[model samples]
Target: MSHVTDVPAASPEIARDHFLRRLSVETDCSDVAASLRGGEPDFVLLHVVGSPQAYERRHVPGARHLPHRDISAERMGEWPAGTLFVVYCAGPHCNGADRAAFKLAGLGLPVKIMIGGITGWQDEDLPFASGKEPGVLRP
Candidate 1:
């Protein structure tokens, strides 16, 4: 038998459990939107990267701008303990979100990746704000 066949396939139950675990750890655009609408206080949305021009073009309504390179525990000190930070980048094509998430998690902050990033948000026809004004993006 080929070397690949030597490994046993995961049982259906095991696969299902793995999938559920992964799903539980990741947040989707719709969930983020709902949380924003409900004014959920347990989590914060973070925009991982995007230039000023990019931000002006479009961005998640309430996402805070913090480049991945600048992410640090000190910079995020204002947040309370156990805050679930939902981080996103430009899109699947961009890995900034992954980098930011890794950094934040390493810093002992609770973090989850916003699957699909801003592209996914826009794909869902979610509202986005333009310009440099903070908290100006409205649905």
Candidate 2:
């Protein structure tokens, strides 16, 4: 058999479960951008990497500057217990998003990773917000 078919695909039930599970914990740049444009999003978007200066240089429109290292129970207390956090880092090569997601999950909070991160966002030719604080894109 060809290398492409060396192994059969998972059963439909298995594939369904896998895709559903991934959707639950992950989102892509396009989906996020669309959400941001659709009015107030239900999730809290966070730029989970870089310093304040780096974040100020460029970041997702509504993303807050919250480094993964700063993620903690006390800091997260500002949000409701059921708040859903969407995190992203430099790109797929960076683990800041994963680190933030892990910390959020450990804190018993809901979280999802924005899969393409900044790189992916740029790949889609989307505009970024620049400023010293969060939600700089807001009117």
Candidate 3:
């Protein structure tokens, strides 16, 4: 009998976790702003489920929209290959951001979830587009 060494591939969950930990190109709103001011951000903004309404009302000016549910190879063509992308949901309690990150990483794209989502951005007192609220942006 011959013995063969076998190693399992990393699961999606593990892959997502690993990617998040190793991310050095990620940015929150403040970082995003700095990058934008410096010319362009290092990453692209991705909106999770139900975030469209909020996004359309106001986003980071130049941010492009990539809805979570519509994520796929076909839809991904709109974005550059291996672009440093950041996914964001409504808030910390939401898992949409993480889910989006997982999907993006699975496609071999360098990605990360903006830890606090839009809520955190507001907390930073950063500039954002407005819609329903005086200083809030929503689609």
Please, what are the lDDT tens digits per residue for candidate 3 over residues 1-139? Answer: 3344366668999999987766653557666656666664666766665755766686555555667777897888786777877777777888887788888878888887776777887788767764433232222
Off by over 4 Å in 1: 1-9, 136-139
Cα lDDT over the full model 1 = 0.83
Q: Considering summed lDDT, which 10 consecutive residues are worst modelled in model 3?
A: 130-139
Q: Candidate 2 on 1-139: residue-level lDDT in tens?
A: 9998999999999999999999999999989888888888999999999999999999999999999999999999999889999999999899999999999999999999999999999999988988976663432
List CA RMSD, all candidates: 3.5, 1.5, 9.7
Q: Candidate 1 vs candidate 3: which has greater TM-score?
A: 1
Clashing pairs in 2: none
Model 2 lDDT-worst window of ten: 130-139
Each candidate structure's TM-score, on Cα atoms with residue i matched to residue i, is 0.84, 0.96, 0.69
Q: Candidate 2: RMSD over Cα atoms?
A: 1.5
As for model 1, its CA RMSD to the true structure in angstroms is 3.5
lDDT values, one for every candidate: 0.83, 0.93, 0.69
TM-score, ranked from best to worst: 2, 1, 3
- Runs of candidate 3 with Cα error greater than 4 angstroms are 1-26, 130-139
